[model samples]
Target chain A: MNFFGIPDIYLVILGLLFLSIIMAIIRVIKGPTAPDRIVGLDTINTIVIVSMIIFGLAAGSVIYVDVAIVYAFLSFISTLFIAKYLEGGEF
Target chain B: MLNQLIDIVIYILLAIGVFFNILAGIGLLRFPDVYTRLHAGTKCTTFGSIFLCGSVILYGLRMWILGNVDGSIWVIHTGIALVAILLTNPTGAHALARAAHRSGVKPVGAVIDELENKPTKKSANKMEAKK
Candidate 1:
Protein backbone atom coordinates (compact mmCIF):
# COMPACT_ATOMS: atom_id res chain seq x y z
CA MET A 1 0.00 0.00 0.00
CA ASN A 2 2.74 2.41 1.00
CA PHE A 3 5.68 2.83 -1.34
CA PHE A 4 8.64 4.56 0.22
CA GLY A 5 6.39 5.58 3.11
CA ILE A 6 4.11 7.52 0.77
CA PRO A 7 0.84 5.84 -0.09
CA ASP A 8 0.10 5.11 -3.73
CA ILE A 9 -2.71 7.65 -3.78
CA TYR A 10 -1.76 9.56 -6.89
CA LEU A 11 -2.18 6.52 -9.06
CA VAL A 12 -5.91 6.40 -8.41
CA ILE A 13 -6.30 10.09 -9.19
CA LEU A 14 -4.39 9.77 -12.43
CA GLY A 15 -6.60 6.89 -13.51
CA LEU A 16 -9.66 9.06 -13.05
CA LEU A 17 -8.19 11.82 -15.20
CA PHE A 18 -7.49 9.32 -17.91
CA LEU A 19 -11.06 8.10 -17.88
CA SER A 20 -12.33 11.68 -18.14
CA ILE A 21 -10.07 12.37 -21.07
CA ILE A 22 -11.52 9.40 -22.89
CA MET A 23 -15.10 10.44 -22.25
CA ALA A 24 -14.44 14.06 -23.26
CA ILE A 25 -13.13 12.92 -26.59
CA ILE A 26 -16.58 11.66 -27.38
CA ARG A 27 -18.00 15.15 -26.95
CA VAL A 28 -15.23 16.63 -29.06
CA ILE A 29 -16.36 14.38 -31.91
CA LYS A 30 -20.13 14.49 -31.37
CA GLY A 31 -20.56 18.15 -30.56
CA PRO A 32 -23.32 19.73 -32.63
CA THR A 33 -22.36 23.36 -32.14
CA ALA A 34 -19.01 25.08 -32.21
CA PRO A 35 -19.33 26.35 -28.64
CA ASP A 36 -20.13 22.90 -27.35
CA ARG A 37 -16.79 21.77 -28.68
CA ILE A 38 -15.17 24.78 -27.04
CA VAL A 39 -16.79 23.88 -23.73
CA GLY A 40 -15.48 20.33 -24.05
CA LEU A 41 -11.98 21.62 -24.68
CA ASP A 42 -12.16 24.00 -21.72
CA THR A 43 -13.27 21.21 -19.45
CA ILE A 44 -10.44 19.07 -20.72
CA ASN A 45 -7.93 21.81 -19.99
CA THR A 46 -9.09 22.00 -16.39
CA ILE A 47 -8.87 18.24 -15.97
CA VAL A 48 -5.37 18.14 -17.42
CA ILE A 49 -4.26 20.79 -14.97
CA VAL A 50 -5.41 18.77 -12.00
CA SER A 51 -4.04 15.53 -13.41
CA MET A 52 -0.64 17.12 -13.93
CA ILE A 53 -0.56 18.07 -10.28
CA ILE A 54 -1.36 14.51 -9.32
CA PHE A 55 1.37 13.28 -11.60
CA GLY A 56 3.75 15.64 -9.86
CA LEU A 57 2.96 14.11 -6.51
CA ALA A 58 3.33 10.54 -7.68
CA ALA A 59 6.57 11.33 -9.49
CA GLY A 60 7.85 13.63 -6.72
CA SER A 61 8.40 16.52 -9.06
CA VAL A 62 7.60 20.12 -8.17
CA ILE A 63 8.13 21.07 -11.79
CA TYR A 64 4.86 19.38 -12.74
CA VAL A 65 2.86 21.71 -10.53
CA ASP A 66 4.68 24.69 -11.95
CA VAL A 67 3.82 23.46 -15.40
CA ALA A 68 0.22 22.98 -14.38
CA ILE A 69 0.07 26.59 -13.17
CA VAL A 70 1.47 27.94 -16.40
CA TYR A 71 -0.81 25.63 -18.36
CA ALA A 72 -3.87 26.90 -16.52
CA PHE A 73 -3.18 30.47 -17.59
CA LEU A 74 -2.54 29.39 -21.15
CA SER A 75 -5.79 27.43 -21.27
CA PHE A 76 -7.69 30.47 -19.98
CA ILE A 77 -6.29 32.74 -22.68
CA SER A 78 -7.08 30.23 -25.38
CA THR A 79 -10.63 29.74 -24.15
CA LEU A 80 -11.26 33.49 -24.15
CA PHE A 81 -9.81 33.96 -27.60
CA ILE A 82 -11.98 31.13 -28.91
CA ALA A 83 -15.08 32.60 -27.30
CA LYS A 84 -14.38 35.97 -28.82
CA TYR A 85 -14.05 34.41 -32.22
CA LEU A 86 -17.30 32.49 -31.84
CA GLU A 87 -19.25 35.54 -30.66
CA GLY A 88 -19.23 37.84 -33.66
CA GLY A 89 -16.07 37.47 -35.75
CA GLU A 90 -15.78 41.27 -35.62
CA PHE A 91 -15.14 43.25 -32.44
CA MET B 1 -0.71 4.50 12.08
CA LEU B 2 -1.25 8.06 10.93
CA ASN B 3 -0.17 7.26 7.40
CA GLN B 4 -2.79 4.51 7.27
CA LEU B 5 -5.48 7.00 8.24
CA ILE B 6 -4.37 9.41 5.54
CA ASP B 7 -4.27 6.62 3.01
CA ILE B 8 -7.87 5.75 3.66
CA VAL B 9 -8.96 9.34 3.16
CA ILE B 10 -6.94 9.68 0.03
CA TYR B 11 -8.54 6.60 -1.46
CA ILE B 12 -11.98 7.94 -0.77
CA LEU B 13 -11.15 11.27 -2.37
CA LEU B 14 -9.67 9.57 -5.36
CA ALA B 15 -12.77 7.48 -5.93
CA ILE B 16 -15.12 10.42 -5.67
CA GLY B 17 -13.01 12.62 -7.89
CA VAL B 18 -12.70 9.99 -10.55
CA PHE B 19 -16.40 9.24 -10.61
CA PHE B 20 -17.46 12.85 -11.01
CA ASN B 21 -14.72 13.95 -13.35
CA ILE B 22 -15.41 11.10 -15.71
CA LEU B 23 -19.08 11.88 -15.41
CA ALA B 24 -18.31 15.38 -16.62
CA GLY B 25 -16.82 14.07 -19.81
CA ILE B 26 -19.56 11.51 -20.36
CA GLY B 27 -22.22 14.11 -19.77
CA LEU B 28 -20.71 16.44 -22.32
CA LEU B 29 -20.86 13.70 -24.89
CA ARG B 30 -24.27 12.26 -24.09
CA PHE B 31 -26.20 15.46 -23.55
CA PRO B 32 -28.51 16.60 -26.35
CA ASP B 33 -27.71 20.29 -26.71
CA VAL B 34 -25.15 23.03 -26.27
CA TYR B 35 -26.45 24.26 -22.89
CA THR B 36 -26.64 20.73 -21.51
CA ARG B 37 -23.16 19.94 -22.72
CA LEU B 38 -21.83 23.09 -21.12
CA HIS B 39 -23.56 22.21 -17.88
CA ALA B 40 -21.99 18.77 -17.80
CA GLY B 41 -18.57 19.87 -18.97
CA THR B 42 -18.11 22.76 -16.52
CA LYS B 43 -19.60 21.38 -13.31
CA CYS B 44 -18.23 17.85 -13.44
CA THR B 45 -14.62 18.84 -14.20
CA THR B 46 -14.48 21.48 -11.49
CA PHE B 47 -16.03 19.24 -8.89
CA GLY B 48 -13.89 16.28 -9.81
CA SER B 49 -10.64 18.26 -9.97
CA ILE B 50 -11.30 19.64 -6.51
CA PHE B 51 -11.12 16.18 -4.96
CA LEU B 52 -8.30 15.03 -7.21
CA CYS B 53 -6.03 17.93 -6.25
CA GLY B 54 -7.07 17.52 -2.64
CA SER B 55 -5.82 13.94 -2.61
CA VAL B 56 -2.53 15.02 -4.14
CA ILE B 57 -2.16 17.75 -1.54
CA LEU B 58 -2.76 15.24 1.20
CA TYR B 59 -0.08 13.02 -0.25
CA GLY B 60 2.27 15.98 -0.43
CA LEU B 61 1.55 16.94 3.18
CA ARG B 62 2.31 13.42 4.27
CA MET B 63 5.61 13.51 2.42
CA TRP B 64 6.52 16.86 3.95
CA ILE B 65 5.68 15.67 7.44
CA LEU B 66 7.95 12.68 7.03
CA GLY B 67 10.88 15.09 6.50
CA ASN B 68 10.96 15.02 2.71
CA VAL B 69 11.19 18.78 2.02
CA ASP B 70 10.48 18.41 -1.67
CA GLY B 71 7.31 16.46 -0.88
CA SER B 72 5.80 19.35 1.02
CA ILE B 73 6.68 21.76 -1.76
CA TRP B 74 4.91 19.50 -4.22
CA VAL B 75 1.77 19.46 -2.12
CA ILE B 76 1.56 23.24 -1.68
CA HIS B 77 2.28 23.95 -5.33
CA THR B 78 -0.36 21.48 -6.47
CA GLY B 79 -2.89 23.28 -4.29
CA ILE B 80 -2.09 26.53 -6.06
CA ALA B 81 -2.68 24.85 -9.39
CA LEU B 82 -6.07 23.62 -8.21
CA VAL B 83 -7.04 27.18 -7.25
CA ALA B 84 -6.19 28.34 -10.73
CA ILE B 85 -8.46 25.69 -12.27
CA LEU B 86 -11.32 26.69 -9.97
CA LEU B 87 -11.14 30.36 -10.92
CA THR B 88 -10.88 30.11 -14.68
CA ASN B 89 -12.90 27.09 -15.83
CA PRO B 90 -16.32 28.54 -15.06
CA THR B 91 -15.67 31.95 -16.55
CA GLY B 92 -14.52 30.31 -19.74
CA ALA B 93 -17.70 28.26 -19.84
CA HIS B 94 -19.77 31.44 -19.42
CA ALA B 95 -17.97 33.12 -22.28
CA LEU B 96 -18.57 30.09 -24.46
CA ALA B 97 -22.27 30.11 -23.62
CA ARG B 98 -22.56 33.78 -24.56
CA ALA B 99 -20.74 33.16 -27.79
CA ALA B 100 -22.99 30.22 -28.59
CA HIS B 101 -26.01 32.44 -28.18
CA ARG B 102 -24.64 35.27 -30.31
CA SER B 103 -23.55 32.92 -33.04
CA GLY B 104 -27.07 31.41 -33.35
CA VAL B 105 -26.67 28.13 -31.52
CA LYS B 106 -29.93 27.26 -29.78
CA PRO B 107 -30.84 24.74 -27.13
CA VAL B 108 -31.99 21.25 -28.12
CA GLY B 109 -35.69 22.00 -27.69
CA ALA B 110 -36.00 25.45 -26.26
CA VAL B 111 -39.61 26.64 -26.47
CA ILE B 112 -39.08 30.31 -25.70
CA ASP B 113 -36.18 32.66 -26.18
CA GLU B 114 -36.19 35.14 -23.33
CA LEU B 115 -32.93 36.71 -24.42
CA GLU B 116 -33.34 37.89 -27.96
CA ASN B 117 -30.62 40.54 -27.74
CA LYS B 118 -29.08 40.43 -31.19
CA PRO B 119 -29.10 43.53 -33.37
CA THR B 120 -32.06 43.24 -35.72
CA LYS B 121 -31.56 44.60 -39.24
CA LYS B 122 -35.04 46.19 -39.13
CA SER B 123 -33.81 48.87 -36.74
CA ALA B 124 -30.78 49.57 -38.93
CA ASN B 125 -32.89 49.83 -42.09
CA LYS B 126 -35.32 52.24 -40.46
CA MET B 127 -32.48 54.48 -39.34
CA GLU B 128 -30.98 54.47 -42.86
CA ALA B 129 -34.27 55.52 -44.45
CA LYS B 130 -34.75 58.35 -41.95
CA LYS B 131 -31.25 59.61 -42.72
Candidate 2:
Protein backbone atom coordinates (compact mmCIF):
# COMPACT_ATOMS: atom_id res chain seq x y z
CA MET A 1 0.00 0.00 0.00
CA ASN A 2 2.76 2.41 0.88
CA PHE A 3 4.84 2.48 -2.23
CA PHE A 4 8.03 0.63 -1.49
CA GLY A 5 7.21 1.31 2.16
CA ILE A 6 8.18 5.01 1.92
CA PRO A 7 11.53 4.60 0.24
CA ASP A 8 10.22 4.80 -3.29
CA ILE A 9 8.01 7.74 -2.42
CA TYR A 10 11.05 9.46 -1.01
CA LEU A 11 13.06 8.55 -4.06
CA VAL A 12 10.57 10.49 -6.13
CA ILE A 13 10.66 13.38 -3.70
CA LEU A 14 14.44 13.37 -3.97
CA GLY A 15 14.10 13.65 -7.71
CA LEU A 16 12.04 16.78 -7.22
CA LEU A 17 14.63 18.08 -4.83
CA PHE A 18 17.22 17.50 -7.52
CA LEU A 19 15.17 19.55 -9.93
CA SER A 20 15.06 22.34 -7.37
CA ILE A 21 18.81 22.21 -6.90
CA ILE A 22 19.31 22.66 -10.62
CA MET A 23 17.03 25.68 -10.64
CA ALA A 24 18.92 27.17 -7.73
CA ILE A 25 22.14 26.70 -9.62
CA ILE A 26 20.71 28.60 -12.54
CA ARG A 27 19.85 31.50 -10.26
CA VAL A 28 23.23 31.45 -8.58
CA ILE A 29 24.91 31.58 -11.94
CA LYS A 30 22.67 34.21 -13.46
CA GLY A 31 22.01 36.39 -10.45
CA PRO A 32 23.05 39.97 -11.12
CA THR A 33 24.83 40.49 -7.80
CA ALA A 34 25.56 39.32 -4.28
CA PRO A 35 22.20 39.75 -2.60
CA ASP A 36 20.63 37.78 -5.38
CA ARG A 37 22.88 34.88 -4.55
CA ILE A 38 21.98 35.15 -0.88
CA VAL A 39 18.30 35.11 -1.74
CA GLY A 40 18.82 32.06 -3.87
CA LEU A 41 20.72 30.29 -1.13
CA ASP A 42 18.03 31.06 1.39
CA THR A 43 15.43 29.62 -0.91
CA ILE A 44 17.50 26.50 -1.38
CA ASN A 45 17.86 26.04 2.36
CA THR A 46 14.11 26.16 2.90
CA ILE A 47 13.53 23.69 0.13
CA VAL A 48 16.10 21.39 1.66
CA ILE A 49 14.29 21.46 4.98
CA VAL A 50 11.06 20.41 3.32
CA SER A 51 12.83 17.57 1.58
CA MET A 52 14.27 16.43 4.86
CA ILE A 53 10.81 16.22 6.31
CA ILE A 54 9.68 14.14 3.41
CA PHE A 55 12.63 11.88 3.86
CA GLY A 56 11.72 11.47 7.49
CA LEU A 57 8.22 10.44 6.54
CA ALA A 58 9.58 7.89 4.13
CA ALA A 59 11.85 6.37 6.71
CA GLY A 60 9.28 6.54 9.55
CA SER A 61 12.15 7.18 11.96
CA VAL A 62 11.10 10.64 13.19
CA ILE A 63 14.80 11.38 13.71
CA TYR A 64 14.96 12.99 10.29
CA VAL A 65 12.20 15.35 11.37
CA ASP A 66 14.20 16.22 14.47
CA VAL A 67 17.19 16.99 12.33
CA ALA A 68 14.97 19.06 10.09
CA ILE A 69 13.76 21.17 12.99
CA VAL A 70 17.31 21.89 14.14
CA TYR A 71 18.44 22.60 10.62
CA ALA A 72 15.54 24.98 10.18
CA PHE A 73 16.65 27.12 13.12
CA LEU A 74 20.29 26.97 12.11
CA SER A 75 19.52 28.06 8.59
CA PHE A 76 17.41 30.89 9.89
CA ILE A 77 20.32 32.10 11.95
CA SER A 78 22.67 31.79 9.01
CA THR A 79 20.31 33.70 6.76
CA LEU A 80 19.97 36.51 9.27
CA PHE A 81 23.70 36.74 9.79
CA ILE A 82 24.29 36.83 6.06
CA ALA A 83 21.63 39.48 5.62
CA LYS A 84 23.12 41.59 8.36
CA TYR A 85 26.49 41.25 6.72
CA LEU A 86 24.96 42.33 3.45
CA GLU A 87 23.45 45.37 5.16
CA GLY A 88 26.98 46.57 5.78
CA GLY A 89 26.37 47.26 9.44
CA GLU A 90 27.69 46.02 12.75
CA PHE A 91 25.69 43.06 13.93
CA MET B 1 -16.12 4.10 5.52
CA LEU B 2 -14.70 6.76 7.83
CA ASN B 3 -11.36 5.04 7.75
CA GLN B 4 -11.40 5.06 3.98
CA LEU B 5 -12.15 8.76 4.05
CA ILE B 6 -9.16 9.37 6.28
CA ASP B 7 -6.93 7.45 3.94
CA ILE B 8 -8.10 9.56 1.03
CA VAL B 9 -7.46 12.74 2.96
CA ILE B 10 -3.94 11.69 3.78
CA TYR B 11 -3.06 11.01 0.17
CA ILE B 12 -4.54 14.30 -0.95
CA LEU B 13 -2.62 16.17 1.67
CA LEU B 14 0.57 14.49 0.61
CA ALA B 15 0.13 15.50 -3.01
CA ILE B 16 -0.78 19.04 -2.07
CA GLY B 17 2.23 19.43 0.17
CA VAL B 18 4.69 18.17 -2.37
CA PHE B 19 3.12 20.27 -5.10
CA PHE B 20 3.40 23.50 -3.16
CA ASN B 21 6.94 22.72 -2.18
CA ILE B 22 7.87 22.35 -5.81
CA LEU B 23 6.09 25.59 -6.53
CA ALA B 24 8.16 27.29 -3.89
CA GLY B 25 11.33 26.13 -5.48
CA ILE B 26 10.18 27.23 -8.93
CA GLY B 27 9.07 30.60 -7.69
CA LEU B 28 12.37 31.09 -5.96
CA LEU B 29 14.10 30.49 -9.23
CA ARG B 30 11.73 32.55 -11.37
CA PHE B 31 11.21 35.67 -9.32
CA PRO B 32 13.10 38.79 -10.42
CA ASP B 33 13.91 40.70 -7.22
CA VAL B 34 15.24 39.82 -3.83
CA TYR B 35 12.00 40.76 -2.11
CA THR B 36 9.89 38.78 -4.54
CA ARG B 37 12.20 35.83 -4.29
CA LEU B 38 11.99 35.94 -0.53
CA HIS B 39 8.23 36.05 -0.71
CA ALA B 40 8.10 33.02 -2.95
CA GLY B 41 10.66 31.15 -0.92
CA THR B 42 9.09 31.87 2.44
CA LYS B 43 5.40 31.56 1.72
CA CYS B 44 5.39 28.50 -0.50
CA THR B 45 7.38 26.42 1.95
CA THR B 46 5.22 27.52 4.83
CA PHE B 47 2.04 26.39 3.13
CA GLY B 48 3.70 23.21 1.99
CA SER B 49 4.82 22.34 5.49
CA ILE B 50 1.28 22.63 6.77
CA PHE B 51 -0.01 20.17 4.25
CA LEU B 52 2.87 17.78 4.64
CA CYS B 53 2.62 17.76 8.39
CA GLY B 54 -1.13 17.43 8.19
CA SER B 55 -0.70 14.35 6.06
CA VAL B 56 1.53 12.81 8.67
CA ILE B 57 -0.92 13.75 11.37
CA LEU B 58 -3.78 12.28 9.46
CA TYR B 59 -1.92 9.03 9.02
CA GLY B 60 -1.11 8.99 12.71
CA LEU B 61 -4.72 9.59 13.67
CA ARG B 62 -5.85 6.81 11.41
CA MET B 63 -3.47 4.48 13.15
CA TRP B 64 -4.64 5.69 16.54
CA ILE B 65 -8.24 5.05 15.54
CA LEU B 66 -7.19 1.57 14.64
CA GLY B 67 -5.66 1.34 18.15
CA ASN B 68 -1.94 2.11 17.86
CA VAL B 69 -0.40 4.37 20.53
CA ASP B 70 2.54 5.59 18.43
CA GLY B 71 0.29 7.63 16.16
CA SER B 72 -0.53 10.04 18.96
CA ILE B 73 3.12 10.77 19.52
CA TRP B 74 3.64 11.39 15.84
CA VAL B 75 0.66 13.71 15.67
CA ILE B 76 1.66 15.72 18.71
CA HIS B 77 5.28 16.17 17.63
CA THR B 78 4.31 17.24 14.13
CA GLY B 79 1.97 19.82 15.61
CA ILE B 80 4.82 21.29 17.62
CA ALA B 81 7.03 21.44 14.57
CA LEU B 82 4.34 23.22 12.58
CA VAL B 83 3.91 25.73 15.35
CA ALA B 84 7.61 26.42 15.32
CA ILE B 85 7.59 27.06 11.59
CA LEU B 86 4.54 29.28 11.84
CA LEU B 87 6.12 31.45 14.52
CA THR B 88 9.57 31.79 13.06
CA ASN B 89 9.52 31.61 9.26
CA PRO B 90 7.86 34.93 8.54
CA THR B 91 9.98 36.74 11.11
CA GLY B 92 13.07 35.44 9.43
CA ALA B 93 11.83 36.68 6.08
CA HIS B 94 11.08 40.08 7.56
CA ALA B 95 14.52 40.35 9.08
CA LEU B 96 16.18 39.35 5.82
CA ALA B 97 14.14 41.86 3.84
CA ARG B 98 14.87 44.67 6.26
CA ALA B 99 18.54 43.88 6.14
CA ALA B 100 18.53 43.84 2.36
CA HIS B 101 16.76 47.17 2.14
CA ARG B 102 18.98 48.82 4.73
CA SER B 103 21.96 47.56 2.80
CA GLY B 104 20.68 49.53 -0.22
CA VAL B 105 18.82 47.05 -2.35
CA LYS B 106 16.09 49.16 -3.86
CA PRO B 107 12.88 47.39 -4.74
CA VAL B 108 12.37 46.93 -8.44
CA GLY B 109 10.67 49.95 -10.05
CA ALA B 110 10.55 52.05 -6.92
CA VAL B 111 10.72 55.82 -7.05
CA ILE B 112 11.74 56.71 -3.54
CA ASP B 113 15.05 57.24 -1.78
CA GLU B 114 13.58 57.51 1.67
CA LEU B 115 16.19 55.60 3.62
CA GLU B 116 19.07 57.58 2.19
CA ASN B 117 17.51 61.04 2.44
CA LYS B 118 17.96 61.50 6.20
CA PRO B 119 21.34 63.09 5.32
CA THR B 120 23.20 61.51 8.25
CA LYS B 121 26.26 60.68 6.20
CA LYS B 122 26.00 63.77 4.04
CA SER B 123 25.52 66.07 7.04
CA ALA B 124 28.65 64.65 8.64
CA ASN B 125 30.50 65.24 5.41
CA LYS B 126 29.21 68.82 5.31
CA MET B 127 30.40 69.42 8.85
CA GLU B 128 33.83 68.12 7.90
CA ALA B 129 33.86 70.47 4.89
CA LYS B 130 32.91 73.54 6.99
CA LYS B 131 35.62 72.83 9.51
Report the number of the highest-TM-score candidate. Answer: 1
Q: Weakest 10 consecutive residues, lDDT, candidate 1 chain B?
A: B117-126
DockQ of each: 0.69, 0.58
* lDDT for residue B28 in candidate 2, whole number 0-100: 73
Residue-wise C-alpha lDDT for candidate 1, range A1-91, written one tens digit per residue? 7655444556656766888887787777777668877777888888888787777666766798899999999999999998988776555
| Chain A only, candidate 2, TM-score | 0.85
Where does candidate 2 clash, by residue pair?
A: none
**For each candidate, how many residue pairs have backbone atoms clashing (under 3 Å)?**
0, 0
Q: How is the predicted docking of candidate 2 categorized under the CAPRI scheme?
A: medium
Interface RMSD of each: 1.9, 2.1
- Candidate 2 lDDT over residue span A31-81, tens digit each: 887877877787777777767766777777777777777887888888878
Query: In candidate 2, residue B31 scores what lDDT?
Result: 76
Tens digits of per-residue lDDT for model 1 on B1-131?
A: 98899989988987898889888877876788888888888888888888878888888888888898877686778778888888898898889988888788877688888877556455567789999
C-alpha lDDT of candidate 2 relative to the true structure = 0.76
